[model samples]
Target: MSKHLLCLALCFFSLKTQAQQSDFSNINFTKADAIANKYKGATLESLPILSYNLTSTLKTDVEKFRAIYRWVCANIENDYYAYLKNKKTRNKLKKDSLKLATWNAYFTQKTFKRLLKEQKTVCTGYAYLIKELANLAEIKCEILDGYGRTADVNIEELSIPNHSWNAVQLNNKWYLCDATWSSGIYDLNHYSFKYDYNDGYFLTDPNLFVKNHYPVNTKWLLTDTIIPITSFLNGPIVYPTTFKQAIVPTQPVTLHLEVKQNQEVIFLLKEGNPMDTSNITIEMTSGTYKTSVKPTINKNSDELLEVKHTFDKRGFYDFHIKLKEEYLITYTVKVEKK
Candidate 1:
């Protein structure tokens, strides 16, 4: 009986995942996107009315959720200072659960007040607003807090829960998304938020999503594939452009690598859509010097992009795969004397 129950559970999980991964080739998002743009700068005071305005005209739950997600991404400004403050506080209070909980409680109230007044927020606010709006529209949604890997985060350890995203159930199937990241990017040089909506974060593939986002609750990882947190922490640094191109780093699993000078390292990226391999190049930087090198790129029959590069000099180098002149996934390697 136990073995039979186990098989039944496994079958159910497989079916649930397949249902969420349905192809939406026929679902045109033009109307849904337009509706979200139509009501730009909408107030958050009456969530029921806001939800109705966003979803009432849409026929499908996915479209309804898309509208809500898009509007939040476009309208909300990410407060970097607020995020930094929260991170500092969380890290400082990490050893004390009691103090951490108190700070979280106080910060939650403070966060919402500012969110309503200034239309600015962090990841938690984005996820919360998405959930509230979706729930009001009679769509099931949830806020998932977890570790979000980025260039700024230390790859050596998973210290604290540093980020939050959302999961919505459309047609009884769960899909993952990140409105905060989709909203825009923070320009460190200018010290301001740039409102550039990244469409890739919307209804993202679970396998690709797990590369950067690791939910605190493993069950929220919609895919059946198991990705250990250690692998995620050591993975390549992905930027917003990485998702825009629908590329996944499949080789050299870890971001930091040690290789002998003159030794060739093969890096691979799986593109969701095939592209011209000629435009791919690598930009290598060491200390104060930087140069661009066109590595030997090979496109296999399986759509896997192979970037083979050899370091001729002994030095620590920070390199990135440049796609159409824009830097994508980042990796670093230490080259020792051959």
Candidate 2:
């Protein structure tokens, strides 16, 4: 979702492990929800229905793709409670077949159909469904098999892919999209899905998507520049809205960021242009504690600024890169207890 100037090695995210399903039948999607019906999911039998109802308002190929994607995100929920029995009804059926498959599972047509009828899926199911719908719409799409920064996935754990996204060729330009993430995340604790519709994943910038998703076929990255997996793990977590301008991080942004309690962490910023000094300001805010710091800047030329700070507490602190008081982008830092 973002970009940066210097390529520093530091990435952090967390995810819950595979959870066991439980009773969640009492929970109901609101009646006004588009995907409230059991058959609202994408399926072979529903293709004509979906094509007619969803794409009827669309006039262009791009609109068709967006319509399909919007429909999926609105109606689909990660199948968190599929296996769990509805305690009210004595009938227990295995209608959902999404069993935490590894990176190797092929997105066969059969499995994709099952995901649609059942109304749930992981990353792979999302990829397959999008591809299927895209093909039906005559839009060129590919299932981008890749290694995702799946909740706490470290560099060592990235040997195999843990996720799959989609790439669509629109107007001869290929763009990245993650239907699973766009739809919502699987909440293991609540044993349900959080309906958070995200549009950033659709037609995303390859550089930003590269922060977390590493495609097995690098071509699917759909960018002229590619960042390595190691760099991705070390680089700051970014999103598109995080930056106002394109911040390309090549190297040498940080000397060493190993900060200890009561000690300062030296921070550096290298801008491509030096004359924009009046516009840029770097600040820190602790979301956990609500404390803010505007570090004293050691301006080096118009392009570089060196700053240092000591965080008062150990928690998730956010680094904001701003232009004239407007936050353009952010980098997250984890200050731990000594």
lDDT (C-alpha) at residue 191 in model 2: 69
Q: Write the per-residue lDDT of candidate 1 for residues 210-273, one digit (tens) a residue.
A: 8889989887877676678888888888888788777778898998999998999889888875
How does residue 237 of candidate 2 score in lDDT?
A: 46
lDDT of each: 0.86, 0.56
TM-scores for every predicted model: 0.92, 0.59
Candidate 2 on 1-338: residue-level lDDT in tens? 23542222111110011111011124332331332232354554666666566555555656667777777776766654432222111122123234323212443444455575766666667777788878777788888877776324634344444577887765545667887777766678876788877655666556556766888876566455555667766665443333223343333332123445576755555432233545556676654554445666675565546555676566666666566665544556666678
Model 2 residue 142 CA deviation in Å = 0.6
Error of 1 at 17 (Å): 1.9
Which pairs clash inside model 1? none
Clashes of 1: 0
The TM-score measured for candidate 2 stands at: 0.59
